[model samples]
Each structure stands twice: as structure tokens, then as C-alpha cells.
Target: MNNNVYDCAIIGGGVGGLTLAIQLAGAGRTVILFEKEQYPFHKVCGEYVSMESYDFLERVGMPLSAMDIPIINEVKISSVNGNSFTRKLDLGGFGISRYTLDSTLADIAKNKGVTLLQETKVTGILFEKNLFLISAAQDIYQAKIAIGAYGKRSVVDKIINQRRVKHVSSEKNYVAIKYHVKVELPPNRIELHNFDNGYCGISKVDGGNYCLCYLTKSKNLRDNNNDIKKMEQNVLMKNPFLKKYFTEAVFLYEQPLTISQITFNKRSAVEDHILMLGDSAGSIVPLCGNGMSMAMHASLKAFQLIEQYLDENISRQNLEVLYHNKWNSLFSKRIKTNEYIQYLFGRKLLTNTVIAILKRVPFVTDILINNTHGSKF
Candidate 1:
């Protein structure tokens, strides 16, 4: 192993890690990023970023127009019974596929002088005397500080045996399926269609395609013989709107991508010398449509706190306190609100009632949209 050390080591090359690498490299820090996957890979994501991330993207010198993705200014919510409501979102969001999004940021990081080790996974991190020894498969890297953007369900999370609060209920364990489909969905609109056991979203993406994604209770799929196509045909087809799309939409990709058994209860933000960001930190409910934007925003927070600690201006305890406080202030309430929304959607009666009420109260819809998506950064 070489005895060289970097100023910062980022463990995941997703949106959060790549964004921080670009930011820190621009600030003249010697940083290294380890990603287990190659560029232009698809992540099981909603593929929508809120307006709140516009300023951050601009700061990173990523031109919005250059993305070639569709812009959505309105949102439509529908129920299993075909009842629907439309609302004009106060702030717009963008749709770019993860393949393009990740590659673009990776290119920006490369151009900004951040060392990126693609197809490399960080096995473990050893903390000692204000430095970290990060272990990959056959290589080791030393760094003064580490950021764990390694994402959800990483082996590192298990290795740390991270503490889990008691409130992590079984109801939160779910699965997500996504597909790139060529359809006639409006470029400036996004649809959230709710079925019996869960909901699915559809919107236009960068490559003139539509991202059709859904998060459903795993038990529902299991009860249907573990067949995705059968589950869609029998359960999802019950919803007329989704039935129409599933029957009519031409899938652009060969098959739908799926991530199973996602747990969204909660986890520690900082543990064992690693700071989590994005989904690594905590994931918001998908219906809010702010997951990617939240990930990007969290990168800025993680960068600030890590940079301060690395500069030796703040004690580790104080740094953790500040980071936790900032994270809670920015996202805790929003997450809780989304969780409540998810619960409401789980019940068909409540979902329809809430949509009917919100349709009548335009101001309430505005507030809901604002809370779901914060003001632009």
C-alpha cells in the first residue's frame, strides 16, 4: 500500500458524492472518489429533481439546458377508483435519467481534478488518530476525513452494526420498480397514480423517454406469486389509469429495473468515522418527488461540515452536533410530512378524500406543493 494520503475520501460516486467531489476539488482540495459501478449506469430512482436544486447545479457549472431533459410544472394525482385531481406546482422540477445525470457529474468531477476510481468498492474504513484508512478490494487509501455516500443497503452499513431506533416498522419495508418507457406523457407534467397496495409515478426524462416507477409493499408482490408482470396485470391493472398506460406504453428499455426490500424508517447520519449523505443519510417517501434534489442538497451540507472539520477549526463532537442539527432543520420535518402523506395514500378512502379536499382548497394545494418541494435554492 502506498503511504500517500488524500484530504478527503468519498466512498460512493452517486449524485451526492460526485457533487461534493466537484465542489471540493474546485476549492483546491485533494480528493479521491471510489465508485463500485462504471459511469452511465441506471439507478432505481424517480429521475426527477426539484427546482430547489437549480442553484446547486448552476454552482457546479452544469448547464440546465445542456441536460436536454423535460421540465415539469404541473402534477396530477389519481386514485385506484379513477378519481383524479390536478395542481399547478408553485415550483417546477426537471427529469433527467440517472444514466445521463451520473455521467455528467462524473465528467464534471474529472474535469475539476478529483481522482475517481471507477468500478472500485470501499470494503471498510479504519479510523485512528484523526485519519482514516479506507480499504478497497486490493488497494488501501488514507484520508484525513471520509464521507459515506455509499447509499442504502451497503455492506459498510452492516459492518458498522449501526444502531436502529425502535420505530423502524415492518410497514416501511418496500420495493421499487422502474422502467424507461416510450409513451405520450406530457413533457411538462408528472403523474402519481395510486393502486391498491402502492403508487407509481410517470414523467418524461432526458432521452425523450418516460420513467415509470413504483414503490409497493413487498408482501403484495409475494402474495401474487413473485411475478412482476402478473402483479402488474392483476393488481396494477385494477387502476384504470395505470392499466391504460401499462397496456399502451411501449417500453424503451428491455425490462423494468427493480430494487427490493427498501427500508425507509431511519438510520444514523454519522457512525464510525463516516458521514452519510443522500439516501445514505435518510430517504424520503417517493411520492414527494424530491429524492434526487434532497440528495444533491445534502451533498452541500456534508461538504460544509466535512470541510470545516478537516480544516481543524472545529472539534469532532461539535462538528457532529452541527451536522445533525443542520440535517434535522433542513429535512426532518419534510420527511415526516412525506411519511404522513405516504400513510394517507396507503388507505384508498383517505387518498381520495385528501385529493378531493385539496382540489377544492387551492391554497392548501399550494402549501402541500411548497412543503413537498421547498423554495428553490
Candidate 2:
């Protein structure tokens, strides 16, 4: 944070970036975390976190259990016509808003000596002489290591050649929307309802509120004249379940949180001389219901490897190679498998048939769920 070069310069302050910062700082290493937005903000996230990261988070300093968050053990999914089924989650998850989660991590990161730079937008990053020159609006700073935890999309993707690897043509057409509302959904369950071209997830977070988030093709909104409400009423409401909540839930915000050009395509874990973290590395489809945990899980991986590199336990070359392979082994298959699974979820008839088949044989559902989730870290 001072004029001196840092041990680690982290770009983006979402779940992955913040968690990495906390660990690095707590390890007695100098860290600086850059976030475009201030703390305690809302993000377009499902808010449901798989229990896999529960111990890791508490180990890093988040008193998550004492926070009194919902322990969601059941997953309820429905089809367009309202045909639905419930399955017990194998490694069930919990729910907490990004507003509470990220900000809380920011606080811990600061207390542990991380230079928490809120509202600081990083413009570019350059690697030279085994050091990183981070270009922010304020000024260029130097670091021995740099990481990108920026979510979904960023200009830095192009800056680091992350755009060269094409997985889904271009990533400029996907859109996602989210909101918090007071709904009468069961606190111990998370519901995902499917319709043509998209799906919506509902689950309880802290403060007796529910997180209502969904992802849809951008064309769905385009066809409805770019009106979110109209698109919801016409497409999402066709699910029946979405319609019921939309018509009756007490919306908590004056407006919904929306993001555009969301790309779920696979990305490289290591680019140039920078290590990618969270959504930066690879953003899995939100339908997996574990992006938050994956992002945090990634932090655990990056922090350990980077620390070994800093402690002279390994060479930089070995550090980068290990991070790449470890990240892929842990998350690559899940994201790739979900890409195909997501295609099935987008079509109404395919979703209905798939759900109906899996309903009779519930263990298949567990296999799919387990495929997407991971064991406790």
C-alpha cells in the first residue's frame, strides 16, 4: 500500500480476493486488495454456499456459524409447468448475502494488516523483471505476486490474454439479475425453478430475507424490449413458481441488482505472470449453486501455493505450474461438466424430462449434485 513493492497485489475484492488477502496477511505477508466498490454492497449472487468451505472460512476467521445463517439441507427444483421434486443435499449448504460476507472478510483482512483499498479500480497489470506493475487510477504499484479475483468479466481479461481461449464464442451476450426479498420460502431449503432459456434460485439468507437470483440469455431481455420486469413476467413467470413469488413476495430493494455480459466459459488458471482467482480463473454456471464456495476454495489453493513460493519453498515456475494443475484438478471438471448440464437446464421440455427421470431415481440426483460440489476443505 505504501510506495514500496508489496508481497502480493490482489485485484478484485469479492469472495475469492478477500479470502486470499486475509490468509496472506495473516501469514505475515504484505497484501493490498483493490475493489471497485465499497464494502457491505450487494452482488448478483445466489447467496447459497456449499458446506464444503465452512471449515475453511472459519479457519480463515469468519465466524459463519455464530452468524445464525440458514442451514439449507434440501434442494427443491421445479419445471416450467410447476412439476417439482425435492432431494436431500449430500453436502448441504448454507446461505449468507454477499453484502454481509464480503464486507466481513474485508474487516478481517484489514485487521490482519492487508491494505484494504476500497473503491480502487485497477486499470492494467504488467509483469516484468519477476515483478508486477499494477496500474490503478491512483498510480502504478509494484508487487512480487499479483492475482485476479475480479468476477464474471473484466477488461483485465483481455489485458492478460484470458480472452484468447474461446469456450462459448464471445461472452458479451449473457445477463444475470438478483434481488433480496421477504418471501415465505422454507429456511432449510433452496429452490431452483426452470423455464425456457433460464433458471431462478431462491434461498434464505441472514436477517430473515431471501436471495432471488436468476441467469438468462441476453436475448430473452432483448425480445422483451430490454425491460427486466416484462422479461420476468413473460419468461420466468411461465415457471408458475416464479410467478407466485413475484406476485406476492415483499421486495426489499427499490431496484434489483443486475449485471450484463456474464461469461461462464472456462478460463486459464494462470495467465502471463498473474494467477487468476475466483471468477477470474473460471466462472462455473451459477446453477451449480457453489460458485461462492468455489471462489473461496480457490483462495485456499492460491494462498498456500503463493506462500510456498514466497517462503522460498518452491521456484516461481513451480509455483505457477502447481497452481494451474491444482486448480484444474479441483474445479476444471465441475465447470466443464456443468456447461453441458446448463444447456439441458435452459430448455423447458428437456428440463422437465430430466427432472422427472432423476426424481424416480434420487441417487442420480445426488451424483449430479456431488459432481458439482466438493468435500470439506
Candidate 3:
């Protein structure tokens, strides 16, 4: 048990949590961060980050400009029947693996005086008398504020499940899988291939590796007897582009990293007096290729609000309501737009038609992309 209460305690050491911790600690505020796993682990992410977060990441200690990461400026889309189109991205993005990005950010968080605890799983968070009590393993820690930055889904969600806004449409069960592979792909371009019930994205990341990731309904896996390889061959490989990648790319991992039961349901930005950041608050569909950037952007929003609350500039109630509004203002429209996109791409005929339209009027692709992505923060 720790008797000292920190200024803020962040659950989950993801990009958002790590970035927020860095921000708070850099300003001489006490922060304690918890991560269930040790640093440098892989996550089921697209590995693409939009330009909106480029400057913000640098501000929080990521030297992306000097990192020599791949700058992606073009996009190629292929439908289930192999119909395809290529378009220029209005606001391009960069690629770096979660394995690399999170670890680097974690190192920065530690250096900035954040008490980062690795392999510590927070079992529960309770607000009592205006302070947060965080329980992890056999230890209890205290903080003035608690933040939930634990990605898409977690057991911690059960605590706030009662207060969550139910977005029924976003409740569909989805599975996401990722692999680092050696493939012949253009470094400055990203390719998205849509198949029945799902889509896969591939782009060059750091270390000359390409990240090949996909998200699909869980039923797709069950239809193939819950065998990943069978699902790839029977469902995903139906698309010509995906077939080529499957047959040609040298998969670096023996087994792909995967996450299941992913949902895009609208979650309250503030629940039980604990501020929710990043995917915990709400996640955009993976097909949009902007989730990583959105998560980081939310962190900046949260840091500013948290800073004000810590300085006694705002009441706790005000902080909660303001964060909820700011988060929705920043990302609600984008999430809704991406949800519609995910719907279109998940259907075979609709996907093929959209690709045909995009092929003829390439600017439409730019408009759609701009809608899903945001300006630099």
C-alpha cells in the first residue's frame, strides 16, 4: 500500500496514457502510470498515424522527424472482386509499430519523473471523498485523479459498464489481427483491400517491415472453424490483392497478434469521475487508418483539462463535463463518418461500387479521407 497520493494516476500505458503522463510529469506534476505488460510489446494496430498527430507527438518527446519513419502519402483500395483504385492523400501520415512507439514513449514518461509500473494490472478504481483509490495486485495506490487510457476493451470496463452510453450499432463483435511481414510494398503508400465482412490494410513501418492488419466480424472466423489460416484462405484471400500478399509476403511472426470483441460503441469520456482517454472513450473503425493519431490527440485534450483541474482552475464536475464535450467535439463526427465507411466496405457490392466511384472521381477519396482525419494538433 502506498500512502502518498499522486496528482494523477493513469491506467494503461498506451500512447494516450504515456503521452498524458509525460505531459503531466514534464510540468512537475506527480503521475503514476500502470501497464499490465512490460514495454516494447506488439499490439493489434494498423501502425499508421495521420499527420494531425505528428507535431503533437514531437511535443511529447517523440522525435518522429528524426526517426526516418515511412511517410505515406498515397492510398490504394481494392474491393472484394479485385476492383481497385489509387488516390492521393490530402493529409498523409507516417508509420511506426506500437512495439516501437509505446516503448519509446514509456521511456520518456519514466525520464520525466512519472512512476511507471510495468506488469501491474489495475484491478479497480474507486472515487471516494474526491480522491481515486487504485487497486492493483496486492497493493493500493492513491491519486487525486484517475484516467482510463486502456485501449479498446478491458476488464476495467465492467466498472463503468452501467454508466456507458449504449451505442447498439457499435456492439457488433469484431476481431482484429496483425502481423509484421517482409513484403514488396511501396514505402510511401498504403493499401487497403476489402473482402466480405472485413478489410485489411498494409503499409511500411519502421525497420523495413510492413504491417499487415485486418478486422472482420467474429462470425467470419467461426464460419471457417475458428482457424485463422482457414479464415485467411477461405475469406480474406478471396480478394486478389489480399491473395497476393498472403502468398508472397514473408510473415515475420509465427503467430499473428490478435484482439477480439472490438467495438466502436460510444463510451462516455468521463465515467464514475474517471476521465476516459483514447479508445477507452471511443474508437474509430480501423479502416479509417487514423485511430493512433486520434488516441494521441485525445491525450493532448485530456492533458490540458487535467492541468487546469490540478491547478484548481476548474471544479471536478466542470472537468468531467468539459472533457466529455471536448472529446465529442473533436472525434464524434469522425467516428460516425468512419462507421459509415466501415459499413460500406464491409459489404461486397457496396464496396465494389464505392471503388468504381472513387476510381472515376479521385477527389471523392480525398474528401472522405479528410473527413476521417483531422488537422494537426
lDDT: which candidate is best?
A: 3
lDDT per residue for candidate 3 within 273-362, as digits (tens), equals 999888888888889888888888888888899899999999999999999999999998999999788888878899989888889998
Runs of candidate 2 exceeding 4 Å displacement: 162-172
Q: Model 1, 1-377: lDDT tens per residue?
A: 64879989999998889998998999899999999999979988888889789878978978776667788999988877778888887788989888988898999999999999999988878888888888997988999878888877686675664543334345667889999998877899999998877999999988788999999888779889989999999888888889999999998777789998687766667778577788888888888989778778888887887778878889888887887788778888899888778887846777778777777887887776688776665
| Range of the 10 consecutive residues with the lowest summed lDDT in candidate 1 | 161-170
lDDT by candidate, in order shown: 0.84, 0.89, 0.90
Clashing pairs in 3: none
Candidate 3 backbone overlaps, count? 0
Residue-level lDDT for 353 in candidate 3:
91
Model 2 lowest lDDT segment of ten: 164-173
Query: TM-score rank, highest first?
Result: 3, 2, 1
- Model 3 residue 172 CA deviation in Å: 1.6
Give a tens-digit lDDT track for model 2, residues 112-221. 99998888899888899999999887689999999988887777776775465355543235788999999898899999999788899999999899999998888899
